[model samples]
Target chain A: MSYFVSPIAYIVLLVFTVLSGVFFFIYLEGFAQVQFDTRAQLFQQSFSLTEFVLQPYFGTISVLLLLIIPMLTMRLLSEEKKQHTSELLFTSPITVINIVLGKYLAALALFILMLLFSSIFVIVLYLKGNPDPGVILSGFMGLFLIGASFLAVGLFASSLSQNQIVSAVISFGLLLLFWIIGASSDAETSVVGYLSIINHLDNFIKGVVEVKDLVYYISFIFIGLFLTHIVLDSQRWR
Target chain B: MIKVQNLTKKYGNIVAIDNISFQVNKGEILGFLGPNGAGKTTTMRMITGYMPASEGRVEVSGFDIADDPIAAKNEIGYLPENPPLYDDMKVTDFLDFVAGIKGVQEGRAAKIEDSMNKCGISDVKGRLIGNLSKGYRQRIGIAQAILNDPSVLVLDEPTIGLDPKQIIEIRELIKQLGSERTIILSTHILPEVMMTCSKVVIINKGRIVLETTLGELNEKLDGDNEIHLKLEKYSSDIKAKLSALQSVQNVNDLGSGEFIIKSRQRNNIGDEIARVVIDNNWGLKEIRPKLNTLEDVFLNVISSELKQ
Candidate 1:
């Protein structure tokens, strides 16, 4: 709630929503042009709305979320440390894991709210064209998993510093590194390639709910949150 | 009750608080007195389980802070030197958040009200904490600390910045709270310790130099007692005659019938001074032993320790 109340959160949300909306309409117009050309030539085969519109839309959201998730999570622990409110939380009768999870969940809740806003585009697809419900559900699920993984990384970054800018930079650096790894692991099946979070989301984006991808995302979330807890715990000793 | 045994905190190669030990009995207000950077805040942080000690142990109500942090922390309430407040939050909302995190789910509303009333900040419950005055913020800090109704309260520099009236009000509130809960409040302010603390532990350079009750502190400070005397008539031989007394070590005459007679060690020099004045036909208007203040004792103890 505090995060939502901040103007920066609203600014980030508005920017991401507007950018995604513009990109989605541009893709829709291009797909409509191709469909018009096919109809003018009297072609029997129709355009797959899922291929041209839904997949591209999800892909764009994935990239946009990679940039925006850190903005939402950068202040989670860093701001508390800066304000000295970390003392109150540390002294309270709660474990470090509890603090980490509580903050992570709050950020995740905001991310979920942002995703709900993006769902308005999906509703347009449902009303205007024939979009596969199953594929749409899987793409949303994939977006959620990947976004949550980014938030976990951001959470860990937040625990490393009292400066929000430093945390945000670290988070961006880490997420960008993972995104690069995914892009670079085009032909390799090595362990490093497998560790790329973006690669794991590909299966879900293709509407295939593989156990390996699910496990990968779950482990990513787990590792991120676990590392955050360890950092917070080590702070007490320091 | 709280007990700290040989508590030591080190930052890399720098030792913040050396081997220090103290105890606060149930219902006793223990004043942690020190100069700036004297490790008062470090000690309080360790006791409250906000930070782990590099060495030694702290126990609150028989729960070891390291081994049983949750239970130990549950037994204590803490107010850090800065008050740990969220400036963006309203007073009521902030307290509610604290109550939720502290796990005071049962009767939380009543508890919040009670604490606010006790701290005398119920009127500003709806105002944003950042907009409140420093004194009001301090009270809110105190309200959060006492909201959980813990048996032990650890406050770090509870009255660092406030007006004289606010300081007195906070002192009175602390004294009232001290009737049931064991409290350890740290401050560099001398008179704050003198007025509010039942027992004071003066720390210098991360080590305890003196730990004694306020009553015994006064007695301990009587090592170099002085008697103040104001005479109506001046005599040339008054100073020499007063110094002639075995208990009188020295006489400092102020040239206007005002004199300060130094005693060797807690002697009854006031009676002797009175007798000397009567015998000399010099009218003695006022004569009394100059009591030693906590400030004198603090400076004397700290400087003596530094000298050693």
Candidate 2:
């Protein structure tokens, strides 16, 4: 909550909105070129606004979150330790659930805020033309879940160290590992494929919501928080 | 009230604090005195429930820390050596957040204002904590600790690194707070213990060497007394003559006709030392009792500990 009043919060918000706007326009331009091109005229009817613009726009922002969410969460727990404020929290009447959940929810709120700011592009699409509401809704739900999962991983990384830069690096590294883990999915690698964070979100982006993806993200968040709880509990005894 | 029983902390294969035990009554301030790295921080950490002890347990206001930490921790407020503060927060907002975590559900605004007023930080509640000076920052730390009105306050070197005026003001604040609450303050400073604590516990190398009321500790604290003498002219054998006297115990030559004479049991042997100097035909220019230092008090404790 204190971070909202500091310059770091505004700086991240500005960089994210500006960068997302540029990416939105770039994707719009690419979509425009496909509509007018001579050779692409035949396939134009096959790809609706959902396929070319909204899906990819959501995809680009999802990738953008890969960079921005870590920045937002880098200080979540790491700054608490670096400044020794964890002592104040630990010594107070607050439980570990209060600490972990408060920080995670705070980061999630900031993430939801960034998503709301970028939703202007979707609203613009809604005002200008007819797009599938189902696709848009599912796409947003995917963004929320994927964004939350990313934050969970980032929060775990933040708990692992007292250095913000190290926390960010570890967070980005872990996200990338999960992002590409699905690419190696094969007959023998089915278990690894099931663990791909982006694969679960792929269903939501395409206007399809599955129980497995919902279960996957909800369980991922729990596992991340559970690991954080273990680390914090042992940190005291250590 | 607070109680610690056979508390021990071990890190890996080395013992940090071994079988320590003490308690604080409802309104007494117990000064934890020790040298640097004497496990003062470790002990305070365990007492505050920030760290768990390897063996034994701590009970704060009748709740076992290991069994019911949240309830037990509710009774304690701690100020660590570094003052565990968030620099970017405004003073008032930080206090409000602290209140939320401490579960101060009723009359929070009044409590916040009262704590701020008590610590003398109400004037700077609008300023960023990071922009405050060391004194104001330290005061903010105290204000937050007292915000919830906890029963036990564990302060680890609350007056460390401050000017004399700030130190005196902090001591006064601590003494004032001690009237209604039980406080366990740790410091390596001798005068700090003397001024603010009702009882004193001297720890060294992870063990408590002595624990007594202020009256007895003051006797030991004021036990070391020596006399200094400066001569107008260089003198030989003056130190030997002074050391040989029945009243004087030892003498240190501070080169250029200056000597420091140690007396036994806080004796005022200025006349005996002057008689020795005059009879030895040594020029006597200046003479007075030596100034006491914190080191002298510590040496007194160590020597007394060795005696037993």
Q: Pick the candidate with the highest DockQ.
A: 2
DockQ of 1: 0.66
Alpha-carbon runs more than 4 Å astray in model 1? A38-45, B229-248, B253-258, B263-288
Candidate 1: Cα lDDT at A214: 85
Q: lDDT tens digits, residues B57-107, model 1?
A: 999999999999999999888999998888888899899999988899899
TM-score of each: 0.92, 0.90
> Which 10-residue span in candidate 1 chain A carries the lowest summed lDDT?
A1-10
Give each prediction's DockQ, rounded to 2 decimals.
0.66, 0.75
Return the top candidate by TM-score.
Answer: 1
Fnat for each model = 0.83, 0.91
**lDDT score, candidate 2, position B299:** 78
Clash counts per candidate, in order, are: 0, 0
Per-residue C-alpha lDDT of model 2 across residues B177-211, encoded as one tens digit per residue: 88988999998788788789998888887888878
Listed per prediction, chain B TM-scores read 0.90, 0.85
Candidate 2 chain A minimal-lDDT segment of 10 residues: A40-49
